[model samples]
Target: MRTSRAGTSHTVLWAGWAALAAGAVLCVIGWYGVSGERFAERQLPYLASCTVPGAALIVAAAVLLAHGRDATAAARVEELYALLVAAEPPREEAEGERPVAGELVAVPGGTLFHRADCPLVAGKAEAGPVDEHGRAGLDPCPVCAPDV
Candidate 1:
């Protein structure tokens, strides 16, 4: 079976919960055993046999539970990523239909103008020369900062 980054087994996770429940029961049993006893020496046996072991089981359960949760989250993220990767590819323009070199660019409704090669305008479909929209008086892009 495909495991997550943490590689924690599902069996371990189930065991953790089982251990936690059993530990709780053991602790309760120990408490009851000690509470009914009249002497301190009588309670010591319950502490040694039940309470101490119960507390140890709880600590082990905590580690197992945390590991299991991390693995579960990692697996979920992997599933989401697989789904994203399987989605349809975006449409592309023919080579002839693409914009030519030296196409001045700016984002629509944006304040700055940039050269076609500007990193800010790169890969943006909406970016085009201001004159195409009859827009004017825009400031130069601070990054590219084209003189034009």
Candidate 2:
């Protein structure tokens, strides 16, 4: 089975959080070793090493988290596009007559309905025809300004 984009995004997000937590813990341990009166001076070098690497890990984790969030957003947009494509009417209907007000075309997943010849409908692979009367909940497309 193929792994879903959402699943991958969640995994990346959680991994980033885990890395951040580990980095924080390491930084704390390093700080305690250097500052605590009970620790010997000889341990300072090792503690400094831990502190530097821990800071790097924290930075890496921040970048990973941001990447995961962007991936999730992109996945959502793709899913919406797929839904819109699935809602399109048959090819014959699309090629034939001009759509009336109640017969306006729209993507089922989208919020707005558009005229058959609307400029926005031109290169969108996911765009399809939907009846305004049947899809009563969809609003008019602001750009095309269909009478529906």
Candidate 3:
């Protein structure tokens, strides 16, 4: 099953409790049975067998918890980026300004603000740059920040 941080912590704690209980049971048995040997000496090998699986479960739980934490952190980072680039306050268009504004987007290079249908260069005061795609660079719109 998938384990989160709390799950891992719980697993580890339960394993510890089991170990304690097992030891205690063995101790009670020893005490009641009259014996001249160390409490665990009689059945140490059999008791030791459970340790391997218990330890493995604890480690797996810890790793899953760490992964969950990392995912959470990445989500927070994306949210902060969105907040950083909120739409500019409404304003009158300057005489020289273009009228294009792209929506905030996440790109491989950086956040882009534009429509996917139109290239970042389209809808600019100046002409779009000519390239293999002939897509224009984003224009500097007075109302919104378009890639120019």
Best by lDDT: 1
Q: What tens-digit string does per-residue lDDT give for candidate 1 at 1-148?
A: 3644535557678989999998898899999999999999999999999999999889989998888887778787887887799988766556654445566677878888787778786767777665645447678778976765
Better lDDT candidate (1, 2): 1
Error of 1 at 144 (Å): 2.4
What C-alpha lDDT does candidate 2 achieve relative to the native structure?
0.76
Candidate 3 lDDT over residue span 1-148, tens digit each? 2225445555555555565565555545544443434566664544444444445545554565566566556556656666777757545447444432333322333323344224543434333223223233322333344344
For candidate 3, give the lDDT of residue 110. 30
Q: What TM-score do all the candidates reach, one by one?
A: 0.73, 0.54, 0.31
For each candidate in the order shown, give its overall lDDT on alpha carbons: 0.78, 0.76, 0.45
Instruction: Give the clash total for candidate 2.
Output: 0
What order do candidates take by lDDT, descending? 1, 2, 3
**lDDT over C-alpha atoms for residue 124 of model 2:** 56
User: For model 2, what is the alpha-carbon lDDT of residue 134?
Assistant: 56
Candidate 2: residue 43 lDDT (0-100): 68
Residue 27, model 2: lDDT of: 91
Name model 2 segments beyond 4 Å from true.
1-3, 37-43, 90-148
Q: Which stretches of candidate 1 lie over 4 Å from their true place?
A: 1-11, 84-90, 132-135
The superposed Cα distance between candidate 3 and the true structure at residue 129, in angstroms, equals: 34
- Write the candidate numbers in order of decreasing TM-score: 1, 2, 3
Candidate 3 RMSD computed on C-alpha atoms after optimal superposition onto the true structure? 12.3
Question: Against the correct fold, how does model 1 do in TM-score?
Answer: 0.73
lDDT of 3 at 5: 41
